[model samples]
Structures are given as C-alpha cells and as structure tokens.
Target: MSSLSKLAYYLLHNHSRIAANLVEQGIKEMNIKIPDEEKDHAVCVYETFFQFMGDSLEQETNEIPSKLIEWSKKNAEGQIFSGGKISEIIIRYPVTRKIFADLSTQWAEEFSLTNKESIKILQKMNAMLDVSEVETVFAFEKLTKQMKKDYQKELDTLSNPIVPLKEGIAVLPLVGTIDSYRVNHLMEKVIPEIAHLNLNYVIVDFSGVQTFDETTASYLQQIGSVLRLLGIRTILTGISPQLAQIAVAIGAEFHDVTSYTNVKQALENI
Candidate 1:
C-alpha cells in the first residue's frame, strides 16, 4: 500500500487513542477541569471527531462529515439547555486547534508522509473545525433568540393579566413604563383575553404607571374604544394630573368612559 494509504489506515485504527490523548493534553494545557462523569462524554465527542477526520483523509475530500455538523448543532443546544456558556466551549478552541495541529505533524513524521500530504491533512482538519464552530454559533444564536421571544411572551401574559374583581368586573392594573410594545401587546393579546372573560366592566388602573405620554394616551383611547364596542363599560382609575394633561393634549376624549380616583372607589361605585 502507498504511504498515504498506510497513514489513513493507521489514523482510522488509532483514532480512539488519539482522541483520548488529545483530550488529556488539551485539559492539561488549558488548565481546565472536566467532571468525572462528563469526562467520558468529552472523550467520546473527540473520538467521533477524529474518526470523521480519518474518513476525510481517506477520501481525500475537504467536505466535512454530516455527522460532525449534526453533532455540533446538538452540542450547542445542549449547552444552552444546560445553562452553559458558549464561550466556555469557544475559549478552549485555540488550544484545541494547536493540539490537533501538533498531533497531525507528529503523525506525519511517524508515518514518513510527504510535506504536501501533511499539509493536506492539516488543511482538512482546520476546515472541519471551522465548519463545526460556525454551525455551533449559528445554532446557539437561533435557539437563544427563540428563548427570548418565548420569555417575552410569558412576561407579556403576566404583565397584562386581568384580575376578576367580581362576577362582571375585572381590573387591568397598568404598571411600569408604558411603551409601544406593551400597548401593541395589549391590543393583540389582552383585548382578546378580556373579550373572552364576559366582563361587563374593566377597570384600567394607571396608578402604578411610572410615566404617561401622548402615545400612551392615544393607545388608552384605542383600548377604551374597543372595550366600548364590546358593550363593556370602561372605568379609568388612578389618573394622575400629569396623565390627565397628557390625555387632553393628545385629544384622547374619555367623556363616554367613567373616571374614578382609585380601584377601591371604582369597585365601590360598580
């Protein structure tokens, strides 16, 4: 067999040992510790990586193995789910790359491979690592974005909650700074939820609100209009002087809606 073929054969046969050695050397060089239980899994990952490397060398192709790409995405998802930072995995890459390069050179020497052949192997290894890194980062970003969206949806549901006061009365206590996002959330989600409650009255209390602006006043007017159309009486409570001025400035007429000083008074009157 040719020297290149022999080298490929050796790599395929010794991949497990090479992977173990790489892991051991990597941990020591990076001064990082892996838990005893996790050590086996780490070695297994490296073993699969090395096996794929051998396959690439044997085929003389630069194309990365599909198994490795799938593994990278799955690993990224696992890191996110386990509350582990992607940086933790990324920080070790430089050292890992160095170790792999050194091992490739050592193997080339041992097998008496030509410099051209050595460079080919090293280039293929680097290409595979690059693909793995990109796949991992892409997966991490996609999953993190989805998680944030889901978390915001949950917060919106909690923030705009409709607390039933009585048989036909409910309160929507607006807290925090009012923004366009919150207003849109109310228009889309809260309005439908309120409609389903069969409530005759809804107290929109703005006492806990930190700031009121012209935009918020307009949104409030819109909400009041929708509630009125549903035959639900709208009660405005906790309207500070500042909020009242802003509503008037924005031309948000509340003449048809009932006004009260606070929730207790609104409840008493209702």
Candidate 2:
C-alpha cells in the first residue's frame, strides 16, 4: 500500500472512536434529527463511515469494489427500518459529505503532510464519498419505486370503485386506460371487493374508459363470466364503439354477457 493509504489505515483503525465521533458531529452540523425510532441507526451510520474508510485504506489500489457499494445500500435500508426519512440521504447527507471532506483536509494539515500527501489524502477522501453518494442514490431510487407502487395501488382501489347502490346492486366504474397491471388488479382486488359487497347485480360501467388493448378487452369480458359463476348478474354499460370493435377483433366471447348503452339507461331499463 502507498504511504498515504498506510497513514489513513493507521488513523482509521487506531483512532476509530475519534473518527466515529467526528462523523456524528458532521451529521449534527446538518441539523438532521435522529428520531427515537432510529436511535441505533445513528450508530450504524457512523460505523459505516469507519468501516468504509478503514477498508478502503486497507485495499492496495485505493479503489472500492462494486459489491462494496452494497455497504451504502445496506445502511440506507437500515434507515428505512429505523424510521429515518429518505430525505436524510438525499438532502441532509450531502451537507455531511462536505463536512467530512473538510475534516479530512484539516486532519491532513494537522499531520504536517507535504502538498503531495495532502492532495493524495483529499483524493482518497473524495473517492470514498463519491462511491457512497452514487450508491445511496441507487438505493433511494429502489425505495421510490416501492413507495410509488404502494401509493398507486391505493389510488387504483379508490379510482376503480365498487359502489353499492341498493340491496343486491353495485356499480363499478372503470376510467382511463386498461393495462395488464390494471387487469390483474381487477381480478384480484376488485373481484374480492365485489364478492364482499354481496350484490346480486353489478353494473360495470365503461363510459369513462378511454381505450383498452385486446388483452384488456378480453379480460373485461371475463369479469361477467366470473361473476355469473358466483350467482351475481353483471350488466355491462358504456360500451364505446371502439371498445366493441376491439372486443370483436379479439374473438372474445361476449354473447353470454348482457350489454347496455349507458349506466343511466341500464339503471332505468334493468
């Protein structure tokens, strides 16, 4: 290992407690509160810093591995479990990175390092922070996808409602595009909700739906058949000409399902 890496390894390993204390100070400088739910999480954050710097200094090339990126991701996942907000990673930690960088320069200067040594120390410090920042973003993006999926599922349940109008009668209004995801939700979530409603008659209104693919149209046709097997009578409403054409083109068997022009007309006529 280089002289610089050796010096770093000595400081990080022998003086780990001091380094961890400095990390906590840097975090406090950001004014980011460590909530009670995530109390132990604060310790993990500092411990992660110690491990990363110590391990990087131990390595010969001064280069961190890709799997070592998991170090950052694991810390982030801990934050979630510990009640640390995602904003802490995105907003607060950038400030902490700057603080840690400043501390590294001060330490190098205090050690009376030459200009060459000082530059090498800063370079190593920058390299470590760069990896952490990049990996943290990847972990945050994963959290965002999971969070969005859950929110969308809630919104879907709200938007595609199964409203009970009267005894043994319910209306399900489908709006917007019908994709495979929506089809699966209909069969899974909506079907169960329909069953729980204990309605003998269900009015599946499609007037608000703008478009649907062949697969979606075929799935829609199956809704009536599935309900009929459960002894519920399903009357389809708001069949736009485009939807009708798509249904016919897909060779979907809709002969057994009854159709009405609109929800209002279906309610009045049925």
Candidate 3:
C-alpha cells in the first residue's frame, strides 16, 4: 500500500482514540487543548506523528535523539494550555509521537533486540500510548540519561586507571540506576583501583541510586567475593528495603559482603 493510503487508513480507524488520548495527556502535563479552527493542522501533525512512531518500532532501544525530547518539552511549556485548541492539536501530536517512539524503543529492547521480542514490546508500547505524555517523557528522559551515564562510566573505567589514594581506601559514589552494564564497569574500575592504590578497602555508595535489580545485586555480591580473593575488602553502602528485596529475589546473598546503611556509616565501620 502507498504510504499516504496506509496513513489515511490508520487515521480513519484510530484518530479519535489518538486525539483524545494525546489531548488528555497534554492537559495533565501542561493543561492544553486544540481549538476547533486548527483541527486540520492537528490532524496533519498527528498523521506525521504516527508515521514517526511506526518507523521507530524497528530502531535500536538506545538511539533516541535528545533533540526530540528538548523540542517536545519546549512545545509543552510554551503552548500546552494557552494557545487554545490550535495549540492542543499542533503540540500534542508531536509530543505524543515522541513519547510513543521512546516507549516503543525501550520496550522493544528491554530483553532482546530480535524480531519476536520486538513485536511483544510493540504491543506493550501500544497499551501505554494512552498514558500521560508528560509522565512518559519524564521516565524516558530519566531512564535514557541513566543508560548513557552507565555507558560513559564503563568507557571511563576501561580507559582510565584509578588514582592513588592514601589510607589504603578508595570510594566510588554511585548515583541513579544500576544494571549489568554498570556492574561490569564497576568491576573494571575496582580491580585497577585496587592494583594501583594497593588498597585493602573499596567503598561503593548507593546513596543516589534510584533502583537496583537482581543483576546489580548479584554483581555486588560477586564483587565482594572477588575482592576477598585479591585480599581487598569491598564495602557496600546505602541498602534500602526495596534494594534488599531485589537482592533476595535475585538470590543475591550479601551475607559475605561487607555492607553499611550509608557512605558515612560504611566509612565509620571501615
């Protein structure tokens, strides 16, 4: 089918649902609407918006452009509620499209990047497309940033050696989410830091960490074991009840891992 014909078919079948969902989301985010006179512009934008989302279903999860997020935020802040219905239609279509694209990419690759997994992820994305755009965007932004930070941290850990420290101690302050990628990064950094500083203790502070899953907790458990092998002590700090639950769920036992409630507390114990 021709692109235009396919788009028209989609709109004919899905416009009401799309428009109502997007408008409601925009209202919650910034209190906006589409004016009756500007409905044509809104429809045009929505059509373009759907095309973008459809295309994104096939892309990699970590490839969202930051420009889209900035532009959507700008549109919402400037015209969510005040530009009448014209603003509603004009702004929401693009904003919703970006959100759809972000969620589509995230869900599509949360497990694997194969075709089968991608299709399942797409279904989940469609379900969430009706949620608030503002909240969705917020989560997308936060998650993407954490992913990027984890990536950069890995690169840094691999390329650089730890600086020497006195008192045979080194501290690595961890903020945000922790995943397998981050666990590998920490492992790289810790070994080199231990060798370079000749340190017997390495403290990892989870004070700013928002979430920790099984992979991360298991990584922590392994780190403690590895450090003991090297005759170094691993100190874990900032263990929240939620993280504790995750640790248990993952069968990650910290019984052998030296842990504390916070960095300060860990230091005192050290």
Candidate 4:
C-alpha cells in the first residue's frame, strides 16, 4: 500500500466526480478540504486523503517509496484514520502497476535474459512499438548464438594466433561478423602466420560470409594493410559487388589487396 495507491483509493471512493471533473478541467487533484474541529471525523478523513492525493500526483513519475506513515502522523489527529472504511479504500485504486509488472515479468522470463539484455529489449520495444517484426526477434536470438561461437573461435585463434598453411602458404578464413574484435584477432594471427609458414602470400577467403557490411569491408582493408607491412601479399577472394559497394561507401582503402572470386582462382593467379 503505497501513498500514491492510498491517495488514489480515497480520490475515487469519496470524490468520484472529482476524478472526472479534474480530467475535464485538466486538474490532477482538487484543492484540499481541511476539516474544522466541530465537523465529523469523516470530513477530516476526506481532507487528509485529498491533500495526500495531490502530493502523490505531484510525485507520479518518480520511483521514491511513499513516506505515508510519517505524513499521516504529522497531518492527521490520530496518526491514520484506519477502520473497515480505510481497509476498503486500500483495495480500491487502479491496478495499472500490477499490469505493467506482470508484462515486464513475462518478457524477462520469455528471454531468460538479464541487465543489458533487458535494456536492449526495452530499447527495441520503444523503437519498434507498432512495427512488430517477429522474424527479426527470432533472427536476433539465432545470431546471438552464432556471435558467441565466433567469439570463442576468435579467442582460440588468438591463443595460437597463427595457423600454418599447406606448402608454407597460409589460408586465414574470415567468417561471421567482422567487427573490431575480429580485426584485432586478424592482426594478431596474420603476422605470426606469415613468419611461421615463411609465406610470401596469405589468402584471405571470404567465401562463407553471408553478409557484407561496411564494418566487414573495413576489417578486410585492415588485414590487407597489415599484411603488406609484414612483407606478405594478401590475396582477397569472394569479393561480391555488395562487398565492393560497402567498401566504397565507407571509403575503405583496398588498393593493395589483390582479389579473386575464390581460393582456386587466387591460387592460379599466385
């Protein structure tokens, strides 16, 4: 029983018309009715409830717990006007908070998510309130698993950071989302592979990639940039027009990257 709820109870029960008239007049709460000593205790109860309602409405958007007991002690003659009447009032307020709480709990349980995931869910809901995309939500879950697997592979590759290719020619397969994490791993793995295999050329195959975005294009450029510095030629394969468009859009410098459509084509040219 929060003060806001208590206040709402009294407002609706006693001055029910006040709620309607307030909406008409754009008034959140009516003026408080302070009771005279000669008047009935019911009058005092109503006055106290009115004032409390106003104050509760004032603090509507905040999450502060109600200091209602302290308030009742200071304002009313006998701390709080408690009886069967007041008990009935306690159960009378709107059940909006209950509804919202249930909705939130449902979403949390559905996702089995916490903290950042909750924030992301809230943000997505806020952004796409009307445009319900069920498939997009399903895709996000699937991609989350793929992203986790990609991250694990990155960690393992970083531990060794170098894979020797057949006949001392290394093949560094670039797959999944190519964010900064993958680019950093590429830097770590590239030079070591070049040195360990005594390789003159490293074939960076992008054939298995499902999507090509600017981030991935930039990462490819970064790989080529570093490999050139290590005195190793980087032969990029599977450069789709979409990939090239992304590279152009981001102004990714791919001048030195000798590209082929696939590994066999790259090998023939090398």
Candidate 5:
C-alpha cells in the first residue's frame, strides 16, 4: 500500500483509542466536566469524526462527510436540551484541534509518511472540523430562536388569560408593559378565547398594566369594539389619569363601554 493508504488504515483502526485520548486531553485542558453517561456518547461521536477524517485522507478530498454534518447538528441539539451553552461545546474545539495536530504528526513519523502526505491529512482534518463548527452554530442559533418564539407564545397566553368570575362574567386582566406584540396577541388569541366562553361581560382590567401610550389606547379601543360586536358588555377598570389622557389624546372613545374603579366594583355592579 502507498504511505498515505497505510496511514489512513492505521488511523481507521485506532480511531476509538484516538477519540478517547482526545476527549480525555480536552476535558483536562479545558477544565470541563462531562457526566458519566455522556462521556461514552462523546467518545463515540469523536470516534466517528476520526473515522470520517481517515476516510477523507484516503479520498484526498476536503469535502466534509454528510454523516459528520448530521452528527454535529445532533450534538448542538443535545447541548441545548441538556441546558448547556453552545459556547461550552465550541470552546473544546481548539483543544481537540491541537490534539489532532499532535496525533497527525506522531502518526506520520510512525508510518514513515512524507511531509506532503502529513500536511494533506492535517488539511482534511481542518476542513472537516471547520464545517462541523459552522453546522453546529447554525443549528444552535435556529433552535434558540424557535425556543424563544415558543416561550413568547406561552407568555402571551398567560398574560392575557380570560378568567371566568361567574356563569356569564369573565375578567380579562392585562398584565405587564403593553407592546405591539402583546396587543396583536390579545386581538388574535384573547378575543377568540373570550368569544368561546359565551360570556355577557368582559372586564378588561388594566390594574396590572405598567404602560399607557397612544398605541395602547388604540388597541384597548379595538378590543372593546370587538367585544361589543359579540354582544358582550365591556367594562373598563383601573384606568389611571395618565391612561385616560393618552386615550383622549389618541381620540380613542370608550363612550359605549362602562367604567369602574376596580374589578370588585365592576363585579358588584355587573
């Protein structure tokens, strides 16, 4: 066999040991701890990576293996699900790269491979690792964004809950600072929930609201109009003077809506 083929054969045969050593050296150098259960999985992933590297060296191509790309994505997802940061996963790459470089040099000397052949192995290893890093980061970012969107959807559901007070009465409490997103959530989600409840009165209490602006006034007016259209009497409570001023400034009329000092007053009168 050619020197390059022999070196590739050696690497392929000893990948498991090389992977274990890489992980051990990485953990020691980086001062990071991996759980016992995860350690085996980590070693397996690295072993596959080394095997792919060996394959690349034999093929004399810099193209990353599709299996390695898939594995990198899975690793990124695992990190997110395990409550670990992407940075934690990425931080070990440098240590791993150094270990691979050292191993490549040592293996070249043992196999009596020429300098060009050794450099070719190093080049393939670098290319595979670079692509793996990119894939991992991209997957991590995409998952994180999706997670934030889901969390916001859950928060919106909680913030605009329609709590039933009696058979035909419910309270729609608006909590936290009002934003365009929350306003849209109210129109899209809360309105449908209110309609399904078959309620006669909906007291949109703003006692917990921390923001009063022209846009907020407009959204509040729109909600009141929608409830009126559904034949539900809308009661406005906890409208501070600042809120009242903004409502007037924005020309948002609540003439048809009843006003109350608080939920207790609205509940008692309704």
Candidate 6:
C-alpha cells in the first residue's frame, strides 16, 4: 500500500476512539447545549466522516467522494428516523472538519511531508467537507417529502370513511373542501371498499363539504361512472345551491347517478 493509504487506514482504525474523545472537545468548541443522545449522535457522525475520508485516501480515486455523498443522503434519512436532526450535523460540521484537518496535518508532519503534499491533503479534506454539506441538505429534503406523503395518506384515510347503513347499503360522508388529492384518494379507497363490502348502494353525503371547484365536479362524474361499472349505485345528497351552480357552470351532467336532498331522504327512498 502507498504511504498515504497506510496513514489513512491507521487513522480509520482508531476513528471510534478518536471520535469519542472529539465529541467532548467539539461540544466545548461549539459551546452548544445538546442532550446526551445528541452527544452520542455526534460521535457516530464523526466516525462516519472519518471512515469516508479514510476510504477516499485509501482508494486514491476521484469517485469515492461522490459515492460517499450519495451514501450520506441515505444515511441522513436513517438518522432522521432515529431522532437525529440534519441541522445538528450541519451546525457541527465546521468544528468537526477543523479537528479532522488538524489531525491530518499532524499526521503529515509525522511523515516529514513537504509543504506541497500537506496542502494537497488539506484541499482534499475541504472538498469532502463541502460534499458532506450538500448531501446532508439533500437528505433532509428527501425526508421532508416522505413525511408530507405520509401525512397526506393519513388525511385521506381520515377524511374518507364508509359507514354501513345496512346489508349492501353504506354512507360515505365527505368532510371539508374537495381537492384533487382527496378526490383521487377517495376513488382509490372507496372503489375497493365497495367491492369488498358487496355494497349494492352507497349514499354519498356531502353536507360537511364546504365547497368544490370545477375539477371536483369532474371527479364526482368519474366516481359515478366507476361505481356504475362495478354494479354499485351512488346516490349523492347535500347539493347546496352554490354547488349546483358550479356543476352547471362546469357543464357536468350526472344523468346516470341519482340525487337526493339529504341522507335521511335517500334512506327513506330506499
């Protein structure tokens, strides 16, 4: 192995011990009031960066840094699941990089390396640190997107509910305003539920829904069509005058679907 590679390997092999000590030093240097769990996370973060740096030097390849950046994005996601914030690493990286860079300089001095060789190692260390900053931010954004989707799914489940009125009869009372997301989720959820329940008729009560746009009127038409194909009849109730006007404005015709004034009226008819 090359001399630089050997040095890097030696540093990596002692990384855990060095990181444990560095955590205390870093806390003092940063002067941040962090919890015990955060201290442990700091140790882990330091170890990961040390391992990445060691591999960069050991492999002597231009691609390892890029690969490490990709891997850190996934790593950041996992860390979020474990209650570690991306901001923690972002806030602490400057100090951590300085400590590691100083350690590398000390190593260079030990090897009797000249000024030019020392500068090259410092340059590589700074570049890796830069890559880390970008990757951590990207990972945080990925986590945010995942969280948003999960929240939307939960909202979909909450807003769309199928309550069985009797054998082969059900009521779907939609709450709040209609958006494209809720409309899509309703079709996705209600279609399978109707088939599974063997429902012949469903009373769609929109009394709680405050408003809907032209797109929502289109979705209602589509839902009626899908229910007809599945051999389940949909009876829509609670068409306020404003909603009726919107339906007319949008030129939506629901000739195939039945309409009622309210759920009670629809139930009485059945």
Worst lDDT 10-window in candidate 1: 36-45
Instruction: Provide the global lDDT of candidate 6 against the true structure.
Output: 0.79
Instruction: Write candidate 3's Cα lDDT for 118-199 as tens digits.
Output: 5554554444333335544564456556667877876656543443344887777776777787678768765655666678
Each candidate's number of clashing pairs is 0, 0, 5, 0, 0, 0
Give RMSD to native, each candidate: 2.7, 6.0, 15.8, 20.3, 2.5, 4.3
True lDDT of residue 5, candidate 1: 82
In terms of TM-score, how similar is model 5 to the real structure? 0.86
Go through the candidates in order and give each one's C-alpha lDDT: 0.85, 0.73, 0.58, 0.51, 0.85, 0.79
Between candidates 3 and 4, the lDDT winner:
3
Per-residue lDDT tens digits of candidate 5, residues 1-270? 888788778779999998898888888989878787667877888788878777876876566667778878987999888898999889878887898799879978898878987887777787788998999999999998999999999998877888999999999888888888899898988898889999999998988887766787778778888888999989989988877777788787888788998999999997
Kindly report the root-mean-square deviation of model 5 from the true structure over all alpha carbons.
2.5
- lDDT string, candidate 2, 185-248, tens digits: 9998899888877888899888988888878867876777789888998888998998888777
Query: Roughly what TM-score does model 2 have, to 2 decimal places?
Result: 0.62
Those runs of model 1 whose alpha carbons end farther than 4 Å from true positions after fitting are 211-217, 240-256
- Residue 225 of model 1 has an lDDT of 89
Give, for candidate 3, the lowest lDDT window spanning 10 residues.
Answer: 58-67
Off by over 4 Å in 3: 1-166
lDDT-superior candidate, 2 or 4: 2
List the candidates ranked by TM-score, beginning with the highest. 5, 1, 6, 2, 3, 4
* Candidate 6 residue pairs that clash: none
Candidate 4: segments with Cα more than 4 A from true spot: 1-166, 212-216
- lDDT score for residue 137 of model 3: 55
